[model samples]
Target: MKKSLLALTVISTLLPLAACQTASNQVATAQTAEIDDKSEALKLNELTQQYFEASLARNPLMATFVGVHQYDDKFNPPLSAEFIQETRAFEQAYLDKVNQLDASELTGQDWLSYEIFKYDRQHALAGMDFNQEYMPLSQMGGAHTYFAMLGSGQSAQPFNSTQDYREFMQRARGFAEFMDSTIIFMQKGVESGVVLPRPIAEKVLPQLSSHVVEDITQSVFYAPLTKLDSLENLTSEEKSTLQQDYVAVIRDVIIPAYDRVYQYMKNDYLAGTRSTVGLSALPDGNEWYEHKIQTHTTLPLTAEEIHAFGQREVKRILEQMTKVKDQVGFQGDLQEFFVHLRTSDEFYFDSEEEVIEAYTKVKQKIDTRLPALFSVFPKADYEVRAVEPFRAASAAGASYQAPAPDGSRPGIFYINTHNLKAQPKFLLETLSIHEAAPGHHFQIAIQQEVEGLPQFRKFNNYTVFAEGWALYAESLGKEMGMFEDPYQWYGRLVDEQLRAMRLVVDTGLHAMGWSRQQAIVFMLNNSSMSETDVVAEVERYISIPGQALAYKIGERHIRELREYAEDQLGDKFDIRAFHQQVLVDGGIPMPLLTEKIQRWVASQR
Candidate 1:
């Protein structure tokens, strides 16, 4: 599962104020409390800022993406023993400092920040207790993939200045060092039973080898050199020198670094990798998976519970699909209709342009319709883009990138056109709505734009909130008066079934002793998803345990809250205001979100 920068835990309790002996004494007590609260809030705010700045400095790549440029030149190898120890120390020291503050007097945003900070610190320390650095990189993601994306010239790393060029060079050197560190860890993993699965290692080989090139210009790392004209002050000699630096790095540093890891992975690491695919295969893997489930869902849920819930959800969705199947007057049974949907070219896009145009249409239509259900829309609009070619095949069918806080970059909804079968035509409306407007774009951009919120709350992502909200947004299509065609409605069920299936498949892979094929077959049997899409999705869950559960787990919670709102408020419920209540706080934990909504519902009553 994808995680944001921060985690929240523990709600604060109000400190009991002094009992007044008389009216004058009451006034005196109130005055003293006000002064104390102000002082405490100021200290809390300062500590949050201090922590944020320190966090940025520690994770320079994150800083670069978040528009903090001071750390643009700094690159830290995240997997190094020294880095992990330092990070643990950093979080602990700040956590101790935060604990010293008087949260009793803090209220409103101040109180929320204090609580989120404490949770973020404590939860982070808890998660860090796992030996994650041992199995760091996956074909799905890691420093290797992120580093490649940064070098591609299309990512957040800016290649706009001479300083930028030099900084990237420094980053490249750090990457080389990172490769060495990765090898050290993998060797450690080999000695222990903590290695990547054999299949995962096999998949990573091509990705790593793609970076190693005999010709320097073919290197993804050499992409920045092509755009040197964008640099203003550089003379021909300066440009020539920068070009040489890039070539040298690609030839001597970057490519060799890739080759070293690629060779090791192919020859050495592959043999050491586990034949069994699940986290259960490794030592303490079940504990790690359990922690991941709690961390991602931000609820005390088990694999068994989520798996059973997923089965119920799947059955419910299938019943709806049956109704749609009969409504569409399909000639066959539900399974046959699923096969028809998967096989029919009418449901698949012919070309990438057609797909992008379809999403563009969705953007135009959904943007106008949003006002009916929402009072708050992001100030930043999102663009629909193809996943870059290098990563497209392995990337998710579609994903969203949040817009820059200062409005420098628009949110990007990446549609993977690499596998057109994965982007079925009937599912376009639901997919676009979920990945773009009122989904990730609204949730993320709005989070970034939430006024006076601390940095962590603004940027820290909760997978359950983010993914769940997106899945919930997909359901709003019927409310928006789209999906009138039964096939389109079936498309929504298909999308939902994908998430519901995740709950079962994720748990199955980690906890149920499932083979990779068994997970794939189970998903194919359960949903109308193309085998291509099912394979990718199952592999993704295998790579990252407990992440896929976030969508349904989160969606169900938010939807339940909405249903509760509608039931309790009756005719008085305001959909727009309820959405604002859910979203305006940005990404909150499920319990916090429920409490917030209940509080809103009570106020409305």
Candidate 2:
């Protein structure tokens, strides 16, 4: 890996170092440089290990996700003034050390390592002024929601033994302090003009109420103890002891912690949330938003530029939809055809299992065709599961969770059956390709399986790279001969139009000062999405700014790169190598991706 970084070393060797005229001087310089490089590389690797270990210690829920059990006994305390300052200092020192590393001397995996470290440090430093903790917990999306998932055995939290039970109790006990701090953070947010939009917060109230059962034993979270019979090697006495300990922790620690937060939100924060929309309305709002765009897309595009580009794309996609409308023998224009599809009985699935089965079929077909496009594939297996009910209402239509690096858990593609209408059968094949087969499951798993990449590169993700590839995969319907049916073709266009609408709606809400209602209306006008789907999608854009930009932006980049390769390589271009070049590097900023692809092109030449 280190030698790969120095593929340019021989080129450097031929350059003049005018002062090193003597043989003895050159030998001494070369020997000293070798020792120094090794020393620095070892020091940096140690720092990486230290940081990774500390991160797990600070967030035990994260530890469980990565299959590390040592820190299962603690939860991260809510952000405090002390925490904010210390983290800033920690990142600052880490950045200083990274700046000292000689990246030019590194190659391949080492070069990748240098880039990941630099990018992570620089971005953290860039956001230090944003003060995101002021809105530490939102009813719409925040730590409170994430922690509830942890307590549910279906997630990363363990429920197998007396020791695991005891560990959870210790973690749950910290909830009161965390909730108290959450309130303080939201209170600061209200004073600082960083409140969440009212429409989104109103929707969150129902979810909050659902989670606030008066009896801890009656809560959805209690399913863990009820399902304990599935746990291996546990005797009745141990199970009884674990069950009692869990109920006590939930009743005494967890429930009260939720109640404290619920009351604070109801009494204080809810009333103070802004009736208006947009992050642009907040303090230092423009710059804060620009950072979000750059962070998500890993590109230097301004929101205004993305907004303009979205308008162009919306126009192009709508034209494509018109062609599909004619092919489907729809009697009306594109807009009318959209309305028909949304209300059409044939498009809807009778049950969630049908939707799953449809996707499974897509997977089988796509898997066979994949060999034509690429030589490499993910080693681990993957499965399709319905998104858990508790958070499904707010989750994306279909999302992918990468496998554990050690492969203890298979990758999971969560299909949101929360709204059956949203998961139309027409879109099943496309969605499967996006969230599973050649999309996230393959890309992320292949990256993790890479032998020599740094740990950070394996786990790290750039939203544009990840989401973009998924969106691009959706466009592969024609290539795979799966969009032969006009209805399925329309489904692909509908999904494509949805991404185009996101570009418009997301920029509308965050940049042009559109209300939540306006964003929903725009989506309905342009795409074949139901009102229920439109409302949920708009609220998602509200909670997560600039994230929508990545899909379309990334797809454009990947498609353009493929075109460039075809133009440059002419008959020499290999689809397999093109795919390998893209997926082999995992996720990178689009510019770095271009360079990597160009490097591959040069090698072929």
Candidate 3:
């Protein structure tokens, strides 16, 4: 899936420096000139705001999601070959403009913003070399899924007034155009051998077919009509007109477009899709995989290095699991113990409601204890919801959606109940901590509430920092007094082991040429994850390479920084203050985060 547009807004907030001169004497004069740092900072901030406005003008859906309503009726053209080329060229121009700035002349947050802006442009430009546009749709996340969510009346798209409904009608037209363009891209993918894996293609067919209902009212796209009665701003006549327009759009534009995608996928694309699961099977696969690794982890480690690290982590975690088993006095070897954990009726929930209720209870317990660990808390509150049935079969065990910037929407922690057995009761505490309180909700909401930062900083996410912090939050279960039961402690171990296995499995599949089955077998042999969960995770890695590596790698860096602070400060160490320092600046690259902590440590001394 693409990062949230709110996250991608970093590209829009970059300030371009004055054009550079080629002459040596002019260059020396420019370099030597006394620049007013404060004046330049003001100029930079103004430029960033202007750029953000320009970006919102072009990306309508993004503007809507971020609470900028001016462009809510617009949508970008399809990702056609020409569109991709144009976008790359545009990014390169901005990159060149920013490159003219001297980082040494900036200070504090001004310098931080400059570095972030440069990083965003350069990373985006580099990715343009890969043919990601060709394979635009995936079972993991794609236009098909996101459009359904937006039209479902339960997502970021607002449906509060008649104008909102009318704007979405225009958006529905744009969605049809977008789907047509997707078909074009898939055709190009077929010719270039840049198609999705066969399994993913298979999964996508059912998703598309689900939307092809005979009755217009049954369509997810027709959901707005059902909601018209709730809009007090609309007249009875206006509501009737809106309902008629919705029916016409859903019957003529939306469903037909979905049918087009469905027919093409079932008849043409599936035959061309690759059976090989690894990215290494594609053209320039090695370079593509390497870029993803660096992009996701923001670290210099190679596939081989990450694989070796994962091996060591797996071994160490197994030892911890053995101790847990011994303490519980379970008979049989570790493999048998895994079976016991999987099959025991006690570990499984009877219903989806039970699973949600379990998480709610965990949240209530953790809420009281959070004050001891953090000095800062988000003004935004969060709630837990079960994953929607349409996508839950292929979704992660759990995932988080950050709260809206305007606080109109709360952060959501979606627990997948596709296979309840995959969600063991022992895993509930650790999962709750990671996805909810003091995890994504805490970190992301705090970032949104941060004052004086650029909009990009408030909304942007680095996978390593975000996912890593969540994993680090899981370790806080011990400090928060929630892991008293030996079984719950074992849940923490199992969770950690999952991350450890990701490091190995992600590398194994992408770099080492391991098959999908090989990766699944490796995970099952090493951890207590169900075969159902293991298969989903392995396929997830296959679908999105190198993303899985961020968790353990990010947690390791965070834990190391915390340990360094403690070792240096001794009795003066304040966990709350340390957490505040880490979170106050919002999500950043791992190296920058380390530097920020090191500076804090120095000031304390």
Best by lDDT: 3
Candidate 1 residue 183 Cα shift, in angstroms, is 0.7
Q: What global local distance difference test value does model 2 have?
A: 0.73
What does candidate 3's lDDT look like per residue over 1-605, in tens digits?
11222222222211111011123223333432433354656655654554455455556666666668875665555656555555555556556656767677777788778777778778877876788767767776667776777787777788888787778778888888888988998989899989899987887888888888898777777776777788886688988888888788888877888899999999999999998988889999999999899888988889999999999999999999999999999998999999999989998999999999999999999999999999899998888888877667666788777778888898888888889998899988998899878988898899889999888677677888888999999999999998899999999999899999999999999999998889989999998888988877887788778888988999999999999999999999999999998889888888888888998899999
Q: What does each candidate score in C-alpha RMSD?
A: 7.8, 9.0, 5.1
Report, for all candidates in order, the number of backbone clashes: 2, 3, 0
lDDT of candidate 3 vs native? Answer: 0.80
Q: For every model shown, what is its TM-score relative to the native structure?
A: 0.92, 0.91, 0.93
Q: Output the lDDT of residue 78, model 3.
A: 61
Residue 303 CA displacement from its true place in model 3, Å: 0.3
Query: Model 2 over residues 184-302: C-alpha lDDT tens digits?
Result: 88788889888877776666666666667777767766877777787788898978888887887777777777778778777787899887778788888778889889877888898
- lDDT order, best first, reads 3, 1, 2
RMSD in angstroms, candidate 3? Answer: 5.1
Candidate 1 root-mean-square deviation in Å? 7.8
Off by over 4 Å in 3: 1-38
Candidates 2 and 3 compared: the better one by TM-score is 3
Would you list the C-alpha lDDT of every candidate in the order shown?
Answer: 0.78, 0.73, 0.80
